[model samples]
Target: MSLTRSQVESIAHLARLDISEAELPVYADSLSKILSFVEQLSAADTSSVEPMAHPLDGESQRLRADEVSETDRHEKYQANAPSVTDALYLVPRVIE
Candidate 1:
């Protein structure tokens, strides 16, 4: 499929891109080729083919459960806060 100058310009406008008259022809050819490839791909037969996540063949790896727990140093951290009371950070209330 070949794309005309006007069609290419319209596509550029829709995509929010600016292309000069010279660049239009280059983009037109490239876009037309891509559209043609898509059309060809649509006509291909793949009824017996299975879909794959990746083109490269490899099995997913599993990791062992390493239980590492984290502790919060809230008291030490909140001690440096400008306004903190009873282990809670205080902020100015915006809702009136």
Candidate 2:
């Protein structure tokens, strides 16, 4: 899975990277090696491996009770606003 100079340039352009002409060859070689390594890793046999959601499968996640912990202060906060209607702030229309 070796990457050519043109392929590297296209990848850089798609990723919004500014690869200078002097560094294109370096990037090409580095990206080629990375793709080759990924190919090698993909060739490994993992048919017997079981999929896992978490590495520590024996442990359960502790969760706190879902409850309201704070008092509503919308009226107090809205008092400072210049314009509010139906619990929503009104702003000047800048676009038609």
Tell me each candidate's RMSD, in Å, in order.
11.1, 8.5
TM-score of each: 0.44, 0.47
Q: What is the C-alpha local distance difference test score of each model? A: 0.87, 0.88
lDDT of 2: 0.88
Q: How many residue pairs clash in each candidate at the backbone level?
A: 0, 0
Put down candidate 2 lDDT per residue, 1-96, tens digits, no spaces.
778889988999999999999999999898888888788766778889887788788777878789988799999999999999988899998799
- Off-target runs (Cα >4 Å) in candidate 1 are 44-96
Residue 72, candidate 2: how far off, in angstroms? 18
Candidate 1 lDDT by residue in tens digits, 5-27: 89999999999999998899899
Model 2, TM vs. native: 0.47
